[model samples]
Target: MSRNIYAFLAIILLLLQNCSGQKTDTKFYDKDFKWSIQIPKDFTKVSAKEWAEKQQKGENALEETTGEEVINEAKTIFVFKTDDMNYFEANYQPFDINIDGDYRENNRNVNHALYQTFRDNMPNARIDTLSSTEKIDSLFFYKYETKIYLPNNQILDIIMYSKLFDKKEFTVNIMFTDPKCGKEMIDAWKNSKFEK
Candidate 1:
C-alpha cells in the first residue's frame, strides 16, 4: 500500500492496542519530575524506546503527520518530554519559519501568529490558546481541523498543556488528532504519565 495508507493502518492498530488491554502504569521523565499515570485501555502507549526504534527503522509508523495528508488518514497524537532547554528554545523561538504555506517571518506579522501573538500578549505568564498554522517540523500544518479540499487535510489538536510543577520553566507538549475520534485521543493524553 501507500505510505499514507500504511500510516493510517498503523495508527488504527496502535489505538486499538491501547484500548484493548487493562489500565497500565505509564511513566515519563522530565527535568524535575518523574511522573506516573494510570492509562485507560483506549490509548496506545508510544514509549520513548519504541519511538526511537521506529525512527531507526525508517518507519514513520506512529501516524503523526502534517499538511494535507491528515484528511485521508487518521490523526496522530505525540507526547514526548525534553529537558534540554535549547531544544525547547529552538522550537519556541520566533524565526523566519515556513510550513506548508503559512509563514511567520516577523514576530508581528503572520496569519495565525501563535508564537508572536502569545509572546507579546503574555510576556512572562503561561499562555495558551488555539489557532491555525501552516507549519510543523518546518512544514505546513493545519489547525484543529483539516483545510477544505487540501490534499492532506489533517488537523492537529492540542489537548492539554502543563508547565513543570516545581521547576516552573519546563513545558509539556501533548497533542492529538483524529477526524471523528477526538475524544479517545484526548483521553489518552489527559491520562499520560511522566518519569523523571
Candidate 2:
C-alpha cells in the first residue's frame, strides 16, 4: 500500500512540476515597436546575420517564382523556433501610402481574405477565425487557428495574431507541431503588452 501511495505521490509531483515549469519568464522587448512578450525557454532565436541571409534567399526565390520585382517592406524583429518544430515569428510591414480602407481593418481584412482562399486548396485542413478582434496590449488583433490533419495521424496547428497601427501592420504567427508548445505560447502571449 505504501509503495502504491508513493508512486501516486510521485506522479502528482511530476505533474505539478511540469505545470509550473511551463510558465514563461524570459521577456523580449522590441525597442522599435515598444512591444514586449515573454518567450518560452524552449524556443531559440537565430542570429540576425543568419536571419537576414535566409530572408534574402527566400525573397530571391519568391521573386524567381513570380517573375516580378519583389519589394520587402516588412522588418522582421524576431524569429523564435523550437526543436520540436514549433515556429514563432514577428514582423511589421509598412502599409502602402495609397492604401484605402479603415486603417484598423486594412491589414486584418487582407489577411482574412487571403487565408480564406487557402481553405479551398487545403481540403484536409480545418481553419477557425475569431468572429471579433481580441485586444492584446494596445492593439486589437485578428486571431486565426488552423489544424491540418495528416495521413499518418499527425496534426499541425497554426496560430496567427495581427494588427495595424500607424500605417504599419504587425503580425505574429506560431506554427505548432506540438500542442503543448502552442498552449505555452498562447499563455505567454496572453500576458503580452505594449510598454509605450
Candidate 3:
C-alpha cells in the first residue's frame, strides 16, 4: 500500500509539472515603413514572403472583373497597406444599389457569404472590436472577433483583420480559426518582421 501511494504521488507531481511547463510568448512581425502585427503561437507561419509574391503576381488577374463582381467577392477581413485602392475604387464606384442585399439571397456563394448568414441568424452574435494596440513592428492594425456557425452546427471562433504598412506599399489580411490560437500566429508574425 505504501508503494502504491508513492507511485500515485509521483504521477500527480508529474502532471502538475507538465501543466506548469507550458509557456506563452508574444511574437511580432515588423516591416519597413509599413505596419507590423502580432501572430499568435498556435498558428504555423506559412511563408509570408510567398504570400506577398503571389499577391504581386496576381494583381492583374483580378482586374478583368467589373466593379459589381469585385464588391460581391470583397469579403476580405484585412487590407494591407500595399492594397491597390485603385482596385477598390474600380469595384466600389458610385452605385446607388446595395451590393450586399443583392448577394445575400444567393445560396451558391462561398464560405464568407455563408458565414455572414450565420452571423445574421445568431441570437447571441456580437462583434468585439480591439483597438490598435502594440505595434507588431511598424504596422498599425485593428482586431475583431465574431462567433460564426458552420453548416455542421460547429461554432467557429474567428480572429481577423488587415494590417497596413503604408511606407512599404503593402497590406496583409489574416484570417484564422480558433481565437485562442491567434496568440501563436501573432507571435510568429512578430518574429518574421515582414521583410519579405
TM-scores, one per candidate: 0.30, 0.67, 0.32
Which candidate, 1 or 3, would have the higher TM-score against the true structure? Answer: 3
Clashes of each: 18, 0, 35
For residues 1-196, what per-residue lDDT tens digits would candidate 2 score against the true structure? Answer: 0001111111111211211113234789988678889898867764555555455544554334334545566677776666435666777776643554565455454444434434543456665554347778656787656566654566766666766667766777676768888788787787888975
The 10-residue segment of model 3 with minimum total lDDT is: 84-93
Best-fitting candidate, scored by lDDT: 2
Task: Write model 1 residue lDDT over 1-196, tens digit each, in one string.
Answer: 1122222122222322221222234443333334333333334445544433333222332223312222222122333222111000001111122322222222112213333332433345443445444332232332322111212443333322222123121222333444334454344434545542
Per-candidate local distance difference test:
0.29, 0.56, 0.28
Q: Which residue segments of model 3 deviate by more than 4 Å?
A: 1-68, 71-134, 149-155, 166-181
Overall local distance difference test of candidate 3: 0.28
Sorted by lDDT (best first), the order is 2, 1, 3
Candidate 1 lDDT for residue 148 = 18
What is the full ranking by TM-score, best candidate first?
Answer: 2, 3, 1
lDDT of 1: 0.29
